[model samples]
Target: MKKSKRKLAAIAAGTVAAPLVAIIPATSAWAHGYVSAPMSRQAQCAAGVVQCGGVKYEPQSVEGPKGQRTCSGGSRFTELNDDSKGWKVTDVGQTMTVTWTFTARHRTTNYEYYVGGRKIADISGNNQQPPQTISHQVNFGGLSGHQKVLAIWNIADTGNAFYACIDVNVK
Candidate 1:
């Protein structure tokens, strides 16, 4: 009878621990933000505008180490790095408003924008938590034609940053 009790206790412990084991990894990988306007690569994936992998389920989760240049933020969402992924290109003038939609607002260092591997704009975040929606007017300068814009949100308290890639046609 003691052996049966021990077996039942083990089963109960396993049942209780299984869910926590599953939930722990997911909690660590929870992400916060993404570019909403201009339809970032992950945003497109989430909207079903493009078929994608895991990123489609969480467009705002493309979080990785900062200062990396890839749209995926060098994370597992490598689909964002595919240049031929048939992303819709939005046409805009010399300047356009880039908007970010945040699910969880973290204290931010700054927002950076890059085009053709060149830093085009850097908007200071003042190391403060942002609103649910934030917008920046990014000037393309002399850049024109088809271009891929990389947007990065550097978190003040972490080494990770959220990344988004926007395909656009500058007129």
Candidate 2:
């Protein structure tokens, strides 16, 4: 019985260790929208909406000041900023899903979700909860090719936005 118990323990350890060992050190898995750090790393897309990492945004980042979009869509007053840490790309396929958690002030907060720079959805509310989790999944005609997804958060009290964009190459 003792020998059998030892064998079982060894088998369990191998089960856990095998997966860890097989993971390539440099392999990149899809993560929600905080880009890979060191600040210089970035992904680009054509002139439209794009999803990258865990967040989505309209237009490519290469445009810099010109590419940024307002959370409410079609405005030049203020730009997308992340007070609640904005949305992140959770998964991508025929339908792509993006999610993020954030805290809001005592005022009304407006969150807008977008695909390819077009406003797809939005939620607005006042003084209810913090660390609110917002998520969206869009079916792009069943993942025929590349699709762009973006989420931008706008707090009424503060005119800044937390925004991220990603380019999903659907398979």
Whose lDDT is greatest here? 1
The TM-score measured for candidate 1 stands at 0.84
Q: Using TM-score, give the best candidate's number.
A: 1
Whole-model alpha-carbon lDDT for candidate 1? 0.93
Model 1 worst lDDT window (10 residues): 24-33
lDDT of each: 0.93, 0.42
Candidate 2 lDDT for residue 107: 39
The estimated TM-scores of all candidates read 0.84, 0.39
Model 1 spans with C-alpha error above 4 angstroms: 1-31
Per-residue lDDT over 25-138 for candidate 1, one digit per residue giving the tens place of the 0 to 100 score? 767545499999999999999999998999999998999999899999999999999998899999999998999999988889999999989999999999898999999999
Per-residue lDDT of model 2, residues 1-171, tens digit only: 999999999999999988887785322221112212111112222112223332224221221221356332333212333223333323456765555443332233654556656766666645333244545555566444544455554444333444544545667
